[model samples]
Target: MSDAVQASGAPAPVGHYPHARRVGQLLFLSGIGPRDPASNAIVGNVHDADGHLISYDIDAQCRAVFANVRAVLQASGARWEDLVDVTVYLTDMARDFKAYNRVWAECFPDASRAPCRTTLGINALPTPIAIELKCVAEIKSPLPLAGEG
Candidate 1:
């Protein structure tokens, strides 16, 4: 049976789907954004009250995105070291990839231990956020028996 995973400390999903789903030894995370859990506000967006784009900071968004992913992983009994693969979507690759890369490097650190990633340039995202991350992670630790642990 598959288990839907939702972390209370992570940003609420914008859609009806759960933050992640676990089946067998793997956890599949849905599209995760750079929104703050407490405020439900998009991070790294610099827009006026009318929502006019002023400037954007991919770095800030990257941090929040990683944090959100981490929360989901933690809730699902996974960790960064258990990540197997990831696919990243960016609204503007030419303008934001550099900053996003820097933050990604900090998160993964050693290339040997990093998950395989695919970065794609997209036209738009759900909110004012410019980036979204989705991943699959392996559950390394033993899971509890249903209603037994």
Candidate 2:
């Protein structure tokens, strides 16, 4: 059986979806972006009065996206080291790939423990964020039942 997870520490999903869903020993995270949980603001995004895209800091977005992903993982009773795979989406690969990679290296310092990754350049996202992550993690231990100490 599968169970859905919602992270209180992460931004509310823009549409009808939970943060992650767990089936058996694997947890599958939805596309997580760099929006703040409390404010729902897209980190590193700047817009004009008309809501036109102006500029963004890819590094900041990358860091925030990782944090968001971690929140989902934590809520799902998983760990960073439990991540098995990640798919990254970037709005501007040419301008942001290097900066994103730098932040990625900071989060995952050890290659052996890092999960498999695939990064893609996309035209745009549902939000104004520059980066998003879709992750899959393995739950190392079975979670305790509710009310069980």
Top-lDDT candidate index: 1
Output the worst ten-in-a-row residue range by lDDT, candidate 1.
140-149
Model 1, residue pairs in steric clash: none
Task: Give the worst 10-residue stretch by lDDT in candidate 2.
Answer: 140-149
lDDT of 2: 0.91
Question: Per-residue CA lDDT of candidate 1, range 65-116, in tens?
Answer: 9999999998888888999999999999999999999999999889999999
State in Å the error of residue 14, model 1: 0.2
- Off-target runs (Cα >4 Å) in candidate 1 are 144-149
- Model 2, runs deviating above 4 Å: 147-149
On a 0 to 100 scale, what is the lDDT of residue 125 in model 2? Answer: 91
Give the local distance difference test score of model 1: 0.91
- TM-score for all models, in order of appearance: 0.93, 0.94
Clashing pairs in 2: none
